[model samples]
Target: MPSTDSSEAPNEASTDASTAPWDVHRLPRADGKTFLVTGGNAGIGYFVAEQLAATGATVVLGSRDADKADAAAASIRSRVPDARVRQIRLDLADLASLKASAEALRTDRLDAVVHNAGVKFDQPPRRETGDGHEAMFGINHLGHFALTHWLAPLLAAAPEGRVVTTGSFAATSERLDLDDLESSQDYRPDRTYGRSKLAQMLFGFELDRRLRAAGNTVRSVVTHPGGALDSLTPPRPPLHAPTTGERLRGLPAGILVQGKEAAAWSAVRAVLDPSVSGGQLWAPRIFGLRGTPRLRPVRGHLADAEVAARLWSASRDLTGVEPEFGLG
Candidate 1:
């Protein structure tokens, strides 16, 4: 394994921080590294996988749809013919399937695990997943929580392992209800989604603290893809382009929302940038809407230790996937 550990300094010479917030072109070669990206079939996840693969890293795209995964892999290959990439079946909405996918992963030398899969739209008629939790919360927070717990040992095995969880601006105004994470008593789609994102933020920061306390090298980082417009995603042949109406809608969004490719920069930076340490939050430098990605301060409730501890405990109890190394 590589000798890189938490003590090693970042390859600062490779990426000039003064020139830009993050430049994928300046990323150091990841010839022997491996990364896993959930929901890599489309949107920002696909772009993240593509960027990692472009850096000569072995990227494992995780998605529920086998066909879409294959297409995504093929699309990456078409862009970077020599890109090393593969796919695995991972349904974050389904606990059993998610566990099975984690068990099937080749975790002996994983460098980073990017949790990017999520349900953005508020699916009305709030429903619970197979694990008996709210669908959005289950898929967005609980599912990734379980997967990360299961894969913690593997991440620890790597010299500079990282777990990158995608957060959202919505978390800024939302409060996670630990006593009722599933929103059992009351369920509003938007608030439920906001609470779920906040949960993810809490988990990422809490996990980093736990890893540090336990003297582990693994890093848990949180990032947000600011207003990534889906219409601007890379076109995969045979896949229809944005409709006329969608294009028209994208016109205004184009000004406010960054393309999926650019939006992926935050997550990619969190995982690959050696300067980025555990518990750091990275997001857009603009109005939390679109612009260059940069490291941001964790403020207000985001830095609340009591809430984070409660979330960590509640996650372990709910998922039943106790981390092998992160628990202190």
Candidate 2:
């Protein structure tokens, strides 16, 4: 099992063999690899997809909106002239549609999958998914859970497959109520959102444990984009066009927080860095809010085996999809 030590040092191999820090602008070549970035049409996800595409890998943008996905793909192609990008319609809110989405990949092996898509409501009027679970928890946690189950075989076929789950800083202060996984009883928008992300992070950590026990080469890595602000983000035309006023107002916050592009570094690094091991948590270097990506010790409830195991069981029961690891 991976270490749970809070004081553990960052992995020395996190840097390249030349002892130089990992540079996001110049990623190592991944010509033959295929990566999927959920919600790649906008925000940090778009930047993650763009960065990965720069390495000559085929990137699949998983989004419910076809037009947006097309536009995002176009943007990537324009930026990286040789980029190879595809799109697959994925509606996480509807459980029945995911198997088809997984099948749409049209490839036998998937190198890595970045679970960056999520839903967060800012106001009242509690919502539920098509499956009758809370929207936030259902889409953010359960949807990915089921999708992973269907994609297991394709992942296992890879030489060294990876499942990179994008977690959140909001999850750090929250705890999961496994008894009320869906928050059907007491539902506050912010709290529910936090709990949903917390559940996802828990699932990521627990998944690494199960992968190890199953003797699977596929690794599960978790990452969080801390304090990403749209105003701080660079415009991606129709997807994200921040006004000058918005950029001016966001400058002060940029000192501690960062734009979506910077936020993409953690997940991108987690996906591409050869030294990043399963069970490690990658985040920004400066107080985890902004800076270059680096390894952060897995601590607190994230390292709680008992809670993670319970959450894993609850997730399996709720989704009714058992991830097939092939052996143990």
Candidate 3:
């Protein structure tokens, strides 16, 4: 096993705080590392899975749709030639679905788990997932939350155990609803999505705190693809591409990603960057909110230990995925 925990500092030269975060030439991942990416069938999630495979890591694609998962694995193998990516069935919307996925995968080792699958939309009427939670919070946040809690052991077993959950720029828009999580009264799609994202990010902070408190070595970190991203958006979104995506299709402009290929770097860096010291977040660094990926500083709100603990307790109560390492 590798000697360093996820929170440990890397080799001296790798600690260059001055380096830009979003370089396309990704740093090589550790040999024999394994990663599982949720919603790896298409969009940014697919791109992240593809790049990780290209970096010589075995990747497991977790998607709700089995057929789509098969197709996605085929597409990636075609592109990367020797890609070692597999597919697993994981439905975030249903409790039984999530439980079945966990039960089926009895594997005890995973270096990293990236929670990149989520939904964002503008629906006329409100909807809830099979679990009776609001659409955005249920599927986007709770689904992944439950899944991650189940996978915690596999992550902790790895030499540099890490979990990277994807947050959105939307998280910047709204604060969490400690009082009313589901927004049962005022169910606005946009706000719900933002709240869910906030939930995911907050979960990362809480996970880190719990790991530390329990004397566990697992490291928890979060990453966002940026405002204008092709790779990280949900596969089912109506606006998968930027409305003006065609206009931005010219040459590799200054800091923006021209395509999904370029955008996957932000996530790749988060998983493998030896310099990343746990709590620091990663995202693209440029205007139009797309392009140069960097390990930008995250908002302090995420680091609020009080809010993190509250969110953690709420999540466990809601999903019932009892984490092995208890913080309280």
Candidate 4:
């Protein structure tokens, strides 16, 4: 059995002041490393890709649309000048295409993959993916699950590979209905979306456990960008161009919430912070809504080992792909 004790992992409080609070603007250089950011074409994912690219790492923007992905890459290059950015066509909703998408990366080693892509519907008649699963749960959780399985080999090949799963603060209030993983029975927009993110968080923790049990070098860490709003986000030209009026409208909310760029901090820290360990949850420092990314204890259902294990099993059965982490 994998040891459940987390005592051996470095505690955030124990780290020296110099590195305890990470500077999002001045990330550690990752000259030769490569990272993939799913849904990098827009929103928080785009900023994550841009920040990673600034570190001199080859950042790949994984998106369903080639045009959008290319535009995002170009935007990053515009900002970073000499940024080494690439794009791969990735549609998490279509599970059948993920194997080929992973293969298309064509890299021997992948230092990290930030699973940032997700779908949420505010008003819906309830949608399902091509795989006949609920859209939000399908793309948000199972899609990344299958992608991770296919990318396991490349991740295992890295010196200190990391799988950074982007979760959500909304998940805190939600619980998984293990019997109805598809949400076909109790489908509400917010509830279903929260449950999907909860599922992703569970998968992250369980993946870490399995990696430890198998003695794999790869690590899985989970992070959530708390309360990010587009109106507060700075424009990225063709990608995101919030108007002056929009910024003014969002000013009141800015005190409690943050822009998408600020929201990317937790995931960025999870990827680049050497002190961050597997099975940890990172979030914003202020009310978990807006501030610097900080290490936070996994509480409530997020730490429920039994649920995580069951979810892992269910994910395997649903996706038809066992994440062996190269152990097989």
Per TM-score, the best of the predicted structures is 2
lDDT of 3 at 62: 94
Give model 3's TM-score versus the native structure: 0.84
Ranking by lDDT: 4, 2, 1, 3
1-328: candidate 3 lDDT, tens digit per residue: 0122333223222457676533456557455788888998887888888788888888999998888888888878877767888988888898667766765655678888888998887874778887798888888888888887678767777888788888877787688879889889887889888889999888887777677778887778887777544433323322244444543454344244345555566677778776655765766655315664555555467667788778878888998874554443
lDDT of 4 by residue, 1-328 (tens): 0122456235643376665446788898999999999999999999999999999999999999999999999899999979999999999999999999999999999999999999999887899998999999999999999999999999999989999999998998899999998888878999999999999999999899999988998999999999999999989998899889999999999999899999999999899988888998888877778888877778778899999989988988888996788555
Q: What is the lDDT of candidate 2?
A: 0.89
For residues 1-328, could you state the per-residue lDDT of candidate 2 as single tens digits?
1333555454734545565668878888899999999899988999999999999999999999999999999999988988999999999888889899999999999999999999999998899998999999999999998898888998999999999998898998898887888888888999999998888888889899999988899999999998899999988888889899999999999998999999999999888888888898988877888888878878888899999889888888888886766843
Candidate 3 residue pairs in clash (backbone atoms < 3 Å): 21-293, 21-294, 22-293, 44-231, 44-232, 255-291, 255-292, 256-291
Question: Which residue pairs come into collision in candidate 2?
Answer: none
**Candidate 2: residue 194 Cα off by (Å):** 0.7
Q: How many backbone clashes does candidate 1 have?
A: 0
List model 1 lDDT by residue over 198-317, tens digit each.
999998998888888888899889998888776765555654367767766777777777778888988988888777888888787666667666667677899998999898788778
CA RMSD of all predictions: 5.6, 2.6, 6.1, 3.9
Q: How accurate is candidate 3 locally (lDDT)?
A: 0.73
Q: Which residues of candidate 4, in runs, are more than 4 Å off?
A: 1-21
Q: What is the TM-score ranking, best to worst?
A: 2, 4, 1, 3
Candidates in order have lDDT scores of 0.82, 0.89, 0.73, 0.90
In terms of lDDT, the best-performing candidate is 4
